[model samples]
Target: MEGRNGDAVSLLERYLKDWADESLHAKLAQVFAATNMLQDSLSHYQAALRINPQNEAATADGPKHIETTLSLF
Candidate 1:
């Protein structure tokens, strides 16, 4: 899991450096959420929403991710 998460972060960061878009941010947020990096996920999710308010995936999943993260505490 750790290795997979690290790879996801690395790939996402590399992609983010070349492109900046709501979809990319949303994907990164999803990756982070999968890895239990809730804060980073939330930040990216917010950035995605800020860039495109109509992002259905982010809008639908972001709150669920946050809720799941919060439940861990």
Candidate 2:
């Protein structure tokens, strides 16, 4: 579990190298969200939006996840 978790994080970092691509960014966001890494997910979502404001999935679902995560803080 620990190794898998680390690997996931590493993959996320690698994905970020090409963060300008909305599709790739959204895919990474989904991976983070699936693993319950809400903040990381939100970050990727935001990055996606930054690259392309018209990214519907990032603009809509990103904030929803961010709000849910923030409420926990």
* TM-score, per-candidate, Cα-based: 0.80, 0.68
lDDT score for residue 12 of model 2: 65
Task: Tell me the tens digit of each residue's lDDT in model 1 across 1-73.
Answer: 8898788889988998888888889988888888877888888888888999988867895657596767788
Clashing pairs for model 2 are none
Query: Tens digits of per-residue lDDT for model 2 on 1-73?
Result: 6567668668867866765588777777777777777887888888888889889888775568676877889
Q: Note each model's CA RMSD in angstroms.
A: 2.3, 2.8
Q: In model 2, where do residues sit more than 4 Å from their true spots?
A: 1-12
List where candidate 1 sits over 4 angstroms from the true fold.
64-73
Question: Once model 1 is optimally superposed onto the true structure by TM-score, how far is the C-alpha of residue 54 displaced, in angstroms?
Answer: 0.6
Worst 10-residue lDDT window, candidate 2: 11-20
